[model samples]
Structure formats: C-alpha cells, structure tokens
Target chain A: MSRAYNFSAGPAALPESVLRQVQEEMLEWQGERASVMEVSHRGKAFVECAAAAERDLRELMAIPDDYHVLFLQGGATTLAALLPMNLAGADATADYVLTGHWGEKALDNARPLLRTNIAASGKAGGYVDIPPVGEWQLTPGAAFVHYTPNETIHGIEFRDIPDVGDVPLVADVSSNFMSAPIDVSRFGVLYGGAQKNLGPSGLAIAIVRKDLLGRHGRALPPIFELQNQAKNDSMFNTPPTFAWYVLGLVLKWAREQGGTAAIGERNRRKAELLYSAIDGSGGYYRNAVAPAARSWMNVPFFLPDAALDKPFLQEAEAAGLLGLKGHRAVGGMRASIYNAMPEAGVQALVDFMADFARRHG
Target chain B: MSRAYNFSAGPAALPESVLRQVQEEMLEWQGERASVMEVSHRGKAFVECAAAAERDLRELMAIPDDYHVLFLQGGATTLAALLPMNLAGADATADYVLTGHWGEKALDNARPLLRTNIAASGKAGGYVDIPPVGEWQLTPGAAFVHYTPNETIHGIEFRDIPDVGDVPLVADVSSNFMSAPIDVSRFGVLYGGAQKNLGPSGLAIAIVRKDLLGRHGRALPPIFELQNQAKNDSMFNTPPTFAWYVLGLVLKWAREQGGTAAIGERNRRKAELLYSAIDGSGGYYRNAVAPAARSWMNVPFFLPDAALDKPFLQEAEAAGLLGLKGHRAVGGMRASIYNAMPEAGVQALVDFMADFARRHG
Candidate 1:
C-alpha cells in the first residue's frame, strides 16, 4: 500500500527511507544475532549504535564539546519533572516562559517539585504569539530559565533563543527539534520527545550542558538523574533500545539530507506553502497565530464556517491526507510539516486545500 | 541469516511472527492512514489496539473486573517511584521484601518518598534464597507490601505468591510476566517491564485493583496517577505508542499460543530442561540459587573454572547462542528463556553447555 501523508503533531512522520530500513532490520539488526530490540543495551552492538546516534546528533546540532546527549524514556513530560530535580538546585526558583499549552503544562509539572515563577506568558492572547524577550520578567538568580521553543498545541514558536542573562536557559524543543539548526552552546539544555522530528515514541533526547549536572547528587531517582545517566552512558536502566536505535537511524538520515540547515530550509518552504494556502483563501481559512511566531513544524488553521469542519476532515482523509485534525485545545486543523514532510507533501496539501476551498468557498 | 537463540535478559526476544507482522505493518497499520507510531494515541485505531491488548491481558491473567490495566513508560524503575506516590496513603510505612538488586533499588527509590521497612530480606543468603513468607515481619497497618516475584539477576523466583493479609500487595513481575499464568486477584498490583516475557522495551504494564486507586489527591504528577491513566486510557500523555502497539501484538500472540497457561507450561518445560542440564553437569557447572527458588525465566549458572568464562561466552556467540554471558553483577552464564524463546533455543543452549563442560571440565 502507498503510504499516506501523515501530518500528526507527534509520534509523527518519519522519513520513508528510515521506515524501510527499520522494516528491513526489524527481525535482525545489522546481520547481528537478533533484532536491535532483542539485544541487550549493554551489548557491544547496541552500545555502539547508541554512541553513533549521540555522535551524529551532536554533529548535526553542532553541540559544543561540553554537552552531554542522553537517550531517556517517558518522553518530555517526565523530563519536565526531572528538569527541576536535576537542575533546579534546592530553594532556587525555576523561571518558565509560558507561550502555549506545553509550556503551561511543563510549568504545572515543575511547580510541585520546585519554587517556580512565570517569567513571561503569551496566554493573554490565547497563545497565538510569543512575548518578546525584552518584556520577559527574569527571576534573579534562577536555577534555570525554561521555555518551549515550539509549542505543538498552540502552533507558537520562538524566533530566537531567549536570553536568560547568565542563568541556565533550557528549552523544550519537542516540536521543532531537528527542523532547524540550534545553537547548542547558547543554552544550558535542550530536550525533546523523539517521536516528532527524531524517530519513534518511547524515547526522549536531552542535550544538556555537562557542568549543570551532578549538582543534586544521588538524591533523585537514578533514571531521572542526568549526571548519572551521562556517567553510565544512558544505560543506568534498560533504555528503549529499539526507539533509540530508530532515532539514530533518523539522525543518520537527516545528516545525509545535509543536516539541520538544509532540512530547515525545506521546513521553512513547507510551512510557507501551507500558510500561503491559508492566507490566499480570501478569508475562507485562517490561522490565528501571529506571522512572526508561526511554527515551521505545526501549522494550525481553521475554516470560515465551523459546520464545514466535519466534511473538510472526512474529505481530507479520503484524499489520503491523514491526521490533519487539529489539537482539541485549539479546534480546527493542523498540518504538522516536520523534517520528514517533504515539499511535495505540502504541495499535495496545498493542492487539496485549494481544490477544497474552490468547491466549498 | 537465520535468527540466533537470543538469551539476553531483555530488550529480549520477541516472537518471530510478531516481528514479521510488525515489519509488514511498520509503514501502515491495519490499512490505517498511518503507522501505529505516527498515529495519534487518542485516535480510534490506537484506542482499539490498546483496549484489545488490555482485554487480552485480562483474559490471559484472569484479571477481575475490579482491576484497571495500564500501559505505562519508563520501565519498572519509574514505577517504583510511582508506587509510593500513588499507593502509600499519607505517612504510611510501605513494606518491601528485599530479594535482589531491583528490590533494593526500589526500596531506595521509595525511601525518599515514604517511610519504608524491609518486611523480609534474602540478603542474608546472598540473594540465593527467598526467606519463607511465614517468617516475614509484617508492619502493622502497612500501606502496601511490595516484592519482586522473580529477581532476574539473582535467578530467584517465588514458588507461590506471598499473602500480605488485607494490605495491598504489589509485585514486580518484570522477568516472569506472561511466562506463567498469574492470579490477578492475588495482589492489589502486578506490574512488569515489557522487555521480558511480553514485548519490546519502553512499555510497562500495570494491573491494579480499582479500589486501591485514587487514594492520593492532586499532589502527584498526573502521568504517575493510575486513575488518570485509566480514565484517559493511558493517553495521559503521549505514550510509547509503538511500544504499546507491539505489546498489543505480543499479547495477541500469547493469546494465539493458547493463552498464558499454555505458554507457562512451555516455560516450565524450558526451565526444567536448562536446569536439568546444569544439575547434570556434576559440579562442573553450578547454580547458586536454591532449587525451589529457581526462576523459570532466568537460568544462571557458573562454570567450575571461572577462567574459561570469556572463551565460553565468545564460543557461545560464535555458535549463534547469543547473550549467554551472565550479568556483570553475577558473572558466569545466564540463559533467559522467556515466553518468546522457543524450546529449540533452550535445547541448543543446553547442548552447547554440555559440550563446553565436557571440553573444559
């Protein structure tokens, strides 16, 4: 069967080449004794696989020599809890910039564990814009300044990394990871769930500055301890071996496609194509997000008539454009064009949208 | 190349059929629009897949209507931390039965969260025996009694489920789940990491009694909350959807293989064959654990001359008997024959062991 254009926000589309390669190696990885999933994490083959993945990712992001890349489980939500435990030194306030749902949710997760203060909030405008860095109220001597660079649900993204003024800046880049080049040295940490731009679900990646670790010692759960994970090579416990391996494959694929810079251009083009389609609809369709803050990864838009939503979705699905239904938090439609979504897919989507708008306008 | 006999504890072997099925459907699931990994967890397809997995697990284990099955992430280690926060009522002392490394590690995790007491210990015997249940020191009004039914590293397994006498009993069945038929009503909670005896890594399943939930209020992280997970259908956050789907496939395979009882019987036979080979080695090879406490899933044995361990492992790998090298904690040889390991694989390992013993004796 021909593959459909998958535009789901996350656990989203992987490159077709990677999927085929994974399928080929599903039963036996690299002509090894067993599948990558079947092998031990401590085994030579998997350890090498994991190391290669980290190395490729580091090279892709141009991560500084002092950063530690960790393959973790439980996704980004669990990472939110771990962030405070590992980085938010006891009694230090954790400053969060709430741009959208994920930032708000992350703040909620961190609240119980740390004394937290919102440095900035874009919620007043229903998360359609990012408050400029100049306006953010930075906390004095905060353990870390946290923000979501790309909020998947609200389709908001930061145009540039926030300046936290000597405080460690951490970003939840789950939505926009690998879609563009990131200045790894500017931030103390950046983490994301692997399902979106990386590979599959069940694994998370944390590129954290080395010095920020081991501060809390062994008081936290060993798996939640970034220092311990980095020290033990992310095998403190059994990692999601299969997912990690897939992430490696995806990273390798991305590197072959000329790394994040080239992919970023393609992502920008895809986002522009879809956004142009929405804007060109002559008030028939709309994206509530501000142009400056619009995400290159997730494009959320709505039809003029609410009653047409059902038929639009049904027709979209029938046309082989899948997972276009928007997040329930902001109802309408979302076309998530991550690194794997080619310009052709966006063209296909734009073509469909134009045809649909012509008939339904 | 033909598949080797994978003896790794976990990220262990899955049924070849399941692997093939997964490979075939990696790009598109059930003729659906996206790979199960790409699809949203809240989508109709995944919800059905999760429900089917739960239903199959319930049927296989004979889980009562009062139980809520949860497919969680972050393995057993995370669950250990979740237990105290979820189960232990305010200021209640949680009871732990220390059998091996995992039990001790779990206790360590719980200590920071709650007042915990070692209800029993196998440490005195170097983790080679289960201190009989009758001898356990039950804490008065203990919130819950937690134990490892099988310590994968120590190669010790309980012959029968322990009775905690009206207190909630939680078992970490990571190494032996689905390898045997479990009476779900015998405990308040039965959870296991899926890498062993179930499916791939990254997913853990929890079978918890309904009445034992919702004790803790809004204090805990929502992802760790069992009631919330159940209510949201384990979509509390983006789950390890691919892992969860693979788990469903594994459960379906187990059911097709005539449910847990049939699989358990086969596991018993595999254990007996491997153990008989070890016992028949006439002191040339030895297993330290008490015979009555031997695990049906993990069979660890040591050669009389530990010097030959390296060559034995190398030769075993060359012979397509993979991961025969025992865990570093207990160095020698371990053949973990979970539900996925065919009887032929165990036979091959036994044959290899006999040959090795004869040559090196």
Candidate 2:
C-alpha cells in the first residue's frame, strides 16, 4: 500500500510531489538546520515563506487588491461562526440560501450571532437540488447572502453564482475551492479549509473584501478581528507555520498544473467519467442528486442493494483505491476527485465500479 | 549548518527523533498508502492516533478523569478569548494576575466577553517579576482566576502556583507546558498551543474541568462550545490531524526520555547551564529577569552595550546557535531551551557566549 489513490473527501489527496518535497525538507528546511515546524514564525525565513504562500494564493486566484486574504485556523466552521461577527451590523439580518449540509451549518453557526433569514432551502427536496432563486424569501436590508457553493456531504454544487444584488455574497467553497477558476470579485468572501484542494487540515483561507470588515458594531477580541489579522498579515499571533508552508507548496503545484483553468477542465472530465459510469449502470448504480446540481469534486452514488456497500468499499481498498466510504448522513459511497487527484484515479474507480456491477448485478 | 540548536520561543524546537519519524512517514503512513495529512480525521487510524496522544499527555501530567482534554485550533490566543465565554456567567467577573505580556494579553482577550479584574500586575516592574499574591485584589465571587505560567517574550515564569481559595484557576501554560510535570488537579483549565514542547503549531490543547463548561450563560455557536468539542472528542469539526499525530509522536518520545519528571530535571539543568553562563559573564552579558521569576524555558539576556547585540546574534548564528535574537519588545538575545531543546544545545550556546565575551570584553 504505497500511496494509493486517496479520496477521503478532505484531508484528501495532495500532490505526491508536494509530499515528497515536505519529506525531503522535514529535518532541515531552507538550510535553517531545523524543520519548518521547528522555526519561529516571526523569523525572516518563515516570514518570507509565509509571504510567498500568500502571494502565490493571491496570484493563483486572481484575487482583487481590495480583498484581504487571511490564513486562519479552526477551518471553515470557525469562519462560519466568525462571518456574521465580522461582516454584519448587530441589528442586521443575514440571508441564507441553504442547498446542503454545509450551507445549513453556515446558517446555524451564524444564527447565534445575528438575525438570520432562510431565503431559500433545499432540505425539503432532500438536498438533491438548489432551491430556485425566484422562490427565495428576500430580507430587506440584509447584510449578506450566504450559501455553500459546493457541499461535500450532499454532493451538490452551484454551477453559477446567484445574483443577489446590492448585498454581499459569502460562499463556503471548501470542497470546490481550487478545482476551478472563480470570479473573486463577485463574492464578498470566499473561505474554506485547506485540507481539500489547498494543503492540510489546520489551515483555512479567507478571501475577504477589506471594506466589509470593522462594521460588526461590537467589540471583538483582537484575535477574532479580521481587520487586525489583515493588518498584521495573519501574524497577529503565531500562525500555523508548517501548514502555511505546505499550502505554499500546494499553490506552487497548482500553478505548475497550469492554474485553475486547466485544473478545472481536468476536474470536469473526472466528474463526467465517474457520473457517466454510475448513470450507465442500468439499475446497478444510482446517484440521487439532480444532474444539474452534481458536484465535480465529490460524487456520491449507491449500488442496487445497501448490502453491497461494505463489499464495494472492501474491494475498492483491495484494488488500492481508498476512502470511498460515503458520509454517514448519505450512507452509500463517495468518490472525491479533488485537484490533486489524477484522472487515472477516477478512471480506476470507474473501471472498478463497472467490474463490481457486472459481478454483482 | 546541518541542524542547529533552535532557541526560538515557539514554533520553537521539536525533538529531532520525532521530526525524523515524521519525515520517514510523510509519504505513506501506517500502510494507509497516504500521508497522515492526506487521510480523513474520522478514519480509525487517525482517531486512534489522536486518542493515543491524549492518553500519553494525561499519563505524563496525571490529568484527573473529571477533566476533559481537547485538541483544538487557533492556538493559546484564541483559547484566551474563549476562556471567559465558556467558563463565566454573563455577569461574572474574572480575576487575572498579569505576570508579563501574555498574561496581559489573556486579560485583554477575556475583557470583551465578560467583566475582568486585574487582581495584580507586574507591568509596573517592567514585567521582570510576578507581583506578590498578597497584593492581588481578588473579587469576592469571581468566576475564575487566570494567570500565565510562563511568558515567552518577557521570559518570566511563576516559580509556584498562587493560592486562590475556592476559585477555579485557569493557567495558560503555552511556553512551559511540558517542560515540567504539574499537579493537574490544581487548575480548572490548563490550555496552550502545541508549538513549544509538544510538537508543532496549528494545534492547541485545553484540559478543562467538566463542570466549568456550559456555565457561560450565553448562546455560543457549537464551534465555540468547549463542551461540544469535548463531547465530540475534539472532532466536532476536523481537528488538526497532522499536528495531532506529530504531537502524539513527541509524547511517545517524551515517555522514552522517562516522562515529565526526567524531562523537568533535564530542563532545569538546561536553564541553569545557560543562566549560570549569563550570571558568570562578569558584566558583559545581563539577564534582566529577577532570579526567582526567570523562565526555565526561555532565558532572555542582553549585552553590556546595545551595539554588541547585532554582532552577538551574527556570531551566534554563524556558530550554529540559531534563534538567539531576542523579541523586538526587548531587543537583546534569548536562548529558549524548551523540553525538546537538548542540554547539549544549551551547552553549545553557553560555550559560544563565553567565547564571545572573551573576544569582545
């Protein structure tokens, strides 16, 4: 079992070259005579490394100058909690268009901080599709419109950004972050955990419009101040140095793969390959999500019988394909083909799925 | 400079053995055919690894069963902000004894959440020593009494825990966390970032008395609820898995080095070796901290003239004594000898200092 095709959703597959680089420099980084994890974040070496990472990220995403990129901790969930506190006034009502688990979670996390309105919800449809924007119950004077661009658990994605005029659009792009090129200026904030396409688990990236900050009308501890983090270059305190460094390596790798446009095309092909395999199974395999809402990052499908789920996972593992087990909420199988996951891995999975259907059907 | 003695205050030194092991396992971990960073935190292997780290820490510190240990993100600074939010009632006043920069920071972070009273502060004395406990202005019914056990920047440490009757004692042990064994039952909460003695940055450890949680009379997001994290085994969201794994490795290494009692003894010797060098420098080098309050983890010292600081740092770095430049707040030199910094490294720094003095005197 030497470097299997990992599809664990997050803490997902990373570029093998990046891992090799990390290993090669684990003992002594940049002739510093210590691992990157062992150095001071404020030191010239680590500070330069951190700056390079932010620069690469900004370049990779084509982020606007007005947007302050913050490398934070506690992942997207923490960012979800911090969103209302940072973006909205105390008396403001925030609109949420919940399409899946993560969007619903974003709403829940924000609810405690400010007035929240469920503009639209896909829960009634078992999260199989996004609720139509026309049916949304718009809230007047809403501070922001929140949604999950891609839901890891529900296997749903918004193909296009919703037009929420005059209000800031905040999206959790955790799963589909670097899978494609995004119009960074369209959203007030685009945040996600790095475990999926960026780097590792501990680090989170937030692309926040600078003007959207300092309007919460409440005293936040300096540590929780998004503006303060921006001012200090995300080093108001010691940052997750090693994770930041690895993320830099990942951004470099993403650039070498010809940036997001090329990566997005490959991702599209991977998704089509896996989705077609399931759709063509003819009562053998089924995916519940609407075709238009299918995620390019995570593809969740089920066999003809629930009894085959365990065997499907086992056989997949035996064939050196790992982390195919679905989220407990879904209870079937999920194959996550993130940016770092090669086309060959998806091809292998599709081949395995076909072979399994032929044997078990 | 193959590998030098890194005296960085934090993101500081790590055990060479642990770093080597991490490097060895970086490409494939536990036959998972994926780096630990590439696997799901919910996966069995990572869960067991995280649990093992907690077990080792509990064993090392003799943590009481009634306490819940959590591996969280955002470091000690975030934990400082969370303290009053989780531990105090809406109207409760928390007492803080400020020894140095970190203690003051903890108080600042807690102020926005609840009423805070500075029971005593050493700022008047330039944070060179802890204020006497008898001088503290303890509130009659304070929710908790907070203090920093060791300050990384100021290089001050509490020689002993203060006696605060009937009040829960919350200690931020970020700098001196495992440099010595402690009576865990004495404190209601002991929290710190895992960059110093533990393993790496990006992860934080909080050991809280079970009853202290859910007492904060406020609606907190589930992510902010320490109780919720405790209930979910710190997997309420994905914990920092790679940092947690490396922390586990460091804990195992600590045990092999005969646990905290042995480690503490060694740390004391390391501190003593460097302190004696400063003491014996004959006016050439000076450590400003009061002898009784000087840190066993970080030893900050200055030369007779400010002009010598640059040459001292340059010569030290050239001699493979890294991270010897002091914090900007106190411009001099600091030799942080955390548990991972071997006695030999301290010896090397002391030897270099004596030679520098002989040439420059």
| Winning model by lDDT | 2
Clashing pairs in 2: none
Off by over 4 Å in 2: none
Q: Highest DockQ: which candidate?
A: 2
Model 1: CA > 4 A from native: A216-218
Give lDDT tens digits, candidate 1, residues A276-357.
9899889888999999999999999999877888999999888889999988889999999989988998999999999998
Error of 2 at B254 (Å): 0.5
lDDT measured at residue B292 in model 1 versus the true structure, 0 to 100: 96
* Model 2 lDDT tens row, A129-172: 98887788888779999999999999999899898887999999
Candidate 1 is scored at a TM of 0.97
> By summed lDDT, which 10 consecutive residues of candidate 2 chain B come out lowest?
B82-91
